[model samples]
Target: MTALMKQNIRRITTVLVSSAMSAFATVQTVGNFSVLSMNTAGLPDFLQGNDVPGDKTENHRMIGAKFVEYGYDIINVQELEFKLNLGQDFNYHAALYSTASLPYRTPTSGGVPFGSGLNTLSRYSFTDTTRVKWNDCSNFGGADCLTPKGFTLVRVLLSSSPEGYAYVDVYNIHADAGVTNADLVARASNLRQLSEYIDNWSAGNAVIIAGDTNSRYTRVRDEIRILTRENGMTDPWVELIRDGVDPTEETICANPTTLSYCETVDKMFYRSSPVLNLQAIGWSYESSRFLQPNGDILSDHNPIVATFSWSLPASLRQSELYGGPHDTWFSDTGVLSRIFSPRISTIRFRGGSRLDAVSVAHVDGTSITHGGTGGRASELKLTDGETWTEAKLCLGQRNNRTGVFAIKARTSAGRTLTAGSSTEDCAEFVAPGGWGIVGFVGGSGSEIDKLGFLFAPH
Candidate 1:
């Protein structure tokens, strides 16, 4: 071929590559990360390796190597404790930490017979790290009370997202073992304690909880629903692997390694934040990856890995949706429904004993109303330079039905509007620093059943 023809072909290839790159860039808002949760079976060397194969310290070294090899972004490990006078250069903690590629790690909570045997290793920096001991434990089940088995929390800073800095609260828990009645009660209490702590501390934040739960979804009286139902967490295994169905007692597998439906005690749960949306993209038991050179397993329990895809909305950040179930859902961020103006000019509440409806008017002369039109209407208007800053909503029972009983809206300029009856069962939604409320999202029919806030950077 002629030199001119060859040059033309090269130009065509360049254009095609550029077009593909541009298409990829348009969808760069979504980011992905992976987490691995394992019960390392790191009992003391004298405990005969807790019935798991291989030397305790050596197995830890291999586990760390495998973690790095698999490129897990975060690792939550249970039963990884250090022991004194083991006559080795390093204990289990040092063996794993020194070998893993993850730069940030929490020190072992304590050693065997005393510590919580929980640790977290991550590639991202973390803060507000805390460990809480279980308030209830039963000696009838597996000596759970002997060690301070509970949960650990770390606020991980994910700086690598497309939109810059994001924070996620990560938790690692190890509940009471055994199936005795006392064991079940103590495990239930453990889950309740964690749920309360999450509601208090991690509210409105992205969260991921994983580790050896010592409880099963199929097991009666497990109380695992507290985390999912009460806290709005999603189990990745159930969602991705089990097709959104929990296994029954008859379907429980004795050897999860050989089965596709593996529901083990080692589990992972996650929820999204207002600013960040997280979805489980993949789930795996990871049994083959943790095998020893001799083809034996690394631990008595297989490690579970979950891959998550996260994205940030173009401009709006949402607060947690609150209140009761409704027939329909609405969000101000919808393409055809979003408020065109950056500032909310007016908020009108219609209610008396219970909230009936809400209407928001924007500076651009566009307005949207939701809920039933049965109650008295009250409006709060914002002057120039004024911004909506917060909302307080109370949920209560009215006419034998549960719904929003009170609604209050406050502006940065000290203006306030309140409607309906006041109650103690309330939640406050406030904009984060450098952010302001832009709009609202909720469900409404004859009455406003649920409510949430929308935020944008000021």
Candidate 2:
């Protein structure tokens, strides 16, 4: 059972090896609060099984100090010391009162915790609070039900928001752990119960649900789907996937080869629009920075955080993205013969001839002129919702002629970038100057889709 605990309980220790992290794309932090979720296996001193078995009260205290130093607005902590009679020895109470003194805090759930070991620290006072233990967890087959693995929900003022939506509902959850059929079923039940609670508690208000979900992103099927697709909550990480990139490439795992290093179980789910005037401007996972003063990760799971700005600008609004106007047409030599080497004269301006929309989208389309000649393109029109700071596109070519795709971006200042003679396609560029024209210059013929993208201005 001890070995099984170590094998299954990932919140006790981290596996981050010393390695420089690779750079990811910069995100625009418009008007969102910084929120975090981590499962701190502070109970059962040997949870991490690294050193002698003894109370790690000091380590837990220091972890709280780290959170204070991070200056985030909200944090959801899981798996703290649950021994009720420990009094002063209780690390959770000490950690909270010690380093987190300045920020407003949530009152610790009273009564013997039954081991929920869950708590939320925030920068604002709670307007409403609700806590409940899972009705589905059990300890007979595994040690899951020993602790009260449940969830907490509260509402706080997003004082930083300019959109007048200061009240935001927040749900902090810790689900059952394991891979057996029983474990999976238990987790599924917990999720359903949580979702139902969300539905019953509020009328689809502005909400952010986060914590150690204990679900794997790589799993073919799991409870996360219920929380996301079915529940209508947006996964910020998924929303931030760069245009034209595979969704799987975006990960909380640092080493994919072994699945041994940094992996993700922590998540943040949110909503924006009619009820919640929040927009997710940025999202990232704590990798290199996932450490304590002693240079080791404070917890086994990497922290995932997202930035939301309620006072978002026109460009950062959610509706600005017009994903699939998918107007497609191509010219082949046989019937729909369209000439090759289309000059700026032939470039198709989305939403009309002037390219006057907030942003334009393009894609290398189905070839028509010949089997591999004329490159086809898609047209796009940008409207409302999330504005961006940059424009990007992907370009492909044929082996017959020199594959050259010409792109022209013209600014209000008349400054222009010309991609007249370049083999380089499939790339990103600053978009202070909105695009004017996109067409093929050389290359026997090339198809282009995802011709343009908009990156929100930070």
Which structure among the candidates has the greatest lDDT? 1
- lDDT tens readout by residue for model 2, 225-267: 6766556788776677433122443255641112323347677
TM-score of each: 0.66, 0.55
Candidate 2: regions farther than 4 A off:
1-30, 46-55, 84-90, 110-115, 140-142, 160-165, 241-263, 312-458
Quick one: best TM-score, which candidate?
1
396: Cα error in model 2, Å: 70
lDDT per residue for candidate 1 within 281-390, as digits (tens), equals 99988888888898888888878899998886556666656687544555565431344436667889899888988887777776778888888999988888888888
How far off is residue 155 in model 2, in Å?
0.6
